[model samples]
Target: MTAPLLSVSEISKRYGAVVALEGVSLNVGAGEFFALLGPSGCGKTTLMRCIAGFETPDSGKLTLKSADLSGVPPHRRPVNMMFQSYALFPHLNVYENVAFGLRRKGEREEAIRARVSELLDMTQLAPFGARRINELSGGQRQRVALARALAPRPALLLLDEPLGALDRKLREETQFQLKEIQRKTRTSFVIVTHDQDEALAIADRIAVMRTGKVEQIAAPIEIYEKPATRFVAGFVGEMNFIEGEIARDDGAAFVTSFARLPRAECALPQGARATLGLRPERIEVSRDGEGVAGRVEDFVFRGEYTLLRVRVAPDVVLRVGAYDGRFAIGDDVKLTIAPDAGVLFAESE
Candidate 1:
């Protein structure tokens, strides 16, 4: 149990009458990749800025290695931030941009040169070091920004949507690169992102926020498979929710839906109102009438798989993922789900 690299305790912030962060607290383990994830206005960015000294909390404390950092300035704190914009100096070449931080600290020219060269090589930018910032591609500039942020060798690095500027293909590629670089550097990273997929792809743990409070904090798989709330279940990925009340027939428990569903878990008592969550990919659709009957209302091909919207009831449309794309609109189909594929939560969860 090594001490956490950074600890935020009961931190709160406000903008005039608007509350930005409300008693948000969390710990960042040494060398861990953590993410603050939520949609806009969820207080994620505010918390990140508080850590970077760009914004001050109205109460609570921030600590680094057991020392308080209440009055520290941004540059004086043992942290650096990489903005979504990359923030590379237009007038400087890649090498000089990375060397900017070290040179500001009055390091000897030889030492600065050595560090800059090492970072460039590590980031795979050795061949592009002499090119100006405008000459580099979006991904190249992102690497340059990362190299510059890591140049100072700070205790922690804060990333505010580091990959938001790139196209989908490049963004996915850079996510792996970012994870690899973090592993190599072994520096604690706290990334703030609204992109759920990116956070799930890269973060060791994620804190899902909403309305200036944390909804849940856990590993990606846990958050997706065993969500703490209905919001978490719906937000992390695509889910089909069916509202029903628990019922008992003979010795077995079931939910009153268009098709009676066997209990997945026994936490809720019989007659209690609850919602059943089913992931699109977990459902199997067929035309042989092996399960609940439904009609294919519409579908869209998504390359690796196809999303079929099936109408089981007048108001209930369930989204199902089919790998074969064999069904078409107006086709009658049957949908079946494994007993353990569904999750049950209270109606108000």
Candidate 2:
């Protein structure tokens, strides 16, 4: 009987024969940082646009604060969008850029200045208010965009690839600032991103979309540690899938050609085809141990961990995340996996 802050029900969109969204439905609670994460062309953008009223769904309904959004224009809705391009006015200085929405609404100069000052301080752009948009750095420009979007105090804010333009180093640093600002403002944020790391870092919940459908929706840890489906397991993180079938003889293990996998943490029916989804960090690589023997096919030295691709069988390869980079190419290694480190997904036909 009660309504959420934002609700989308069975929203479907089709561009001619191509289906951009199919029965997509989700809800964003007040002050929740939700992420729409997926690869390109998965319809994340379409769903966000539909929420913003820029694109109307053919067969479903959206409600914000229990009010129907049907036929509502984008600007009329109590929602603001921060585009991927930042969309700041090049000629308008930072202060004016953030104050544009308030001025457009004909707010008195005194009130506009106060609200703009508050947002600038909250977004850490107070000192840069007088700077031209063209003279600001990428991260500073992003802050201006955020401050502008939040100035209107809309119930919801839609961000389309907000950090896509920033370099990796800057993007990583800005992620913390973004989340902090969102927390301080308490505005519900729906961010569309292709970066899994970004989603894991910033979102309170993530909806993993594929082929226009939401495959799974959960907290980031739930998305990574207990993915609901095979598609979700593969999409959210670096998962090593061991193809096997459920074996009834054992308590509940995937019967793989290489070996009978450790008892799966998840339940699967007997004789059902199942896939074991293991994170690289779950498998420990050692020179010698009571574990599966495999030879290192190759290895890459990441800053915090060494990722080793080991051939454990003729047809199976497992990636192990090691804290040390002592592994060399063609070296024999042992991969130790705990019984509960992996979750099993029933393979669909």
Tell me how candidate 2 scores on lDDT.
0.91
TM-score of each: 0.97, 0.97
Task: Report the lDDT tens digits of candidate 2 across residue range 1-349.
Answer: 5567999899999999999999989999999999999999999999999999899899899999989999999999999999999989999999999999999999999999999999999888889989999899999999999999999899999999999999999999999999999999999999999999999999999999999999989999999898988888888889998888987775866688777766845467788887788999998888986788999999888888889899999999899999964988899988777878888777772
| Tens digit per residue, CA lDDT, model 1, 122-221 | 8899999889989999999999999999998999999999999999999999999999999999999999999999999999999999989999989999
Model 2 TM-score, 2 decimals:
0.97
RMSD of each: 1.3, 1.4
In candidate 2 the C-alpha lDDT for residue 317 amounts to 88
Model 1 lDDT, residue 144, Cα: 99
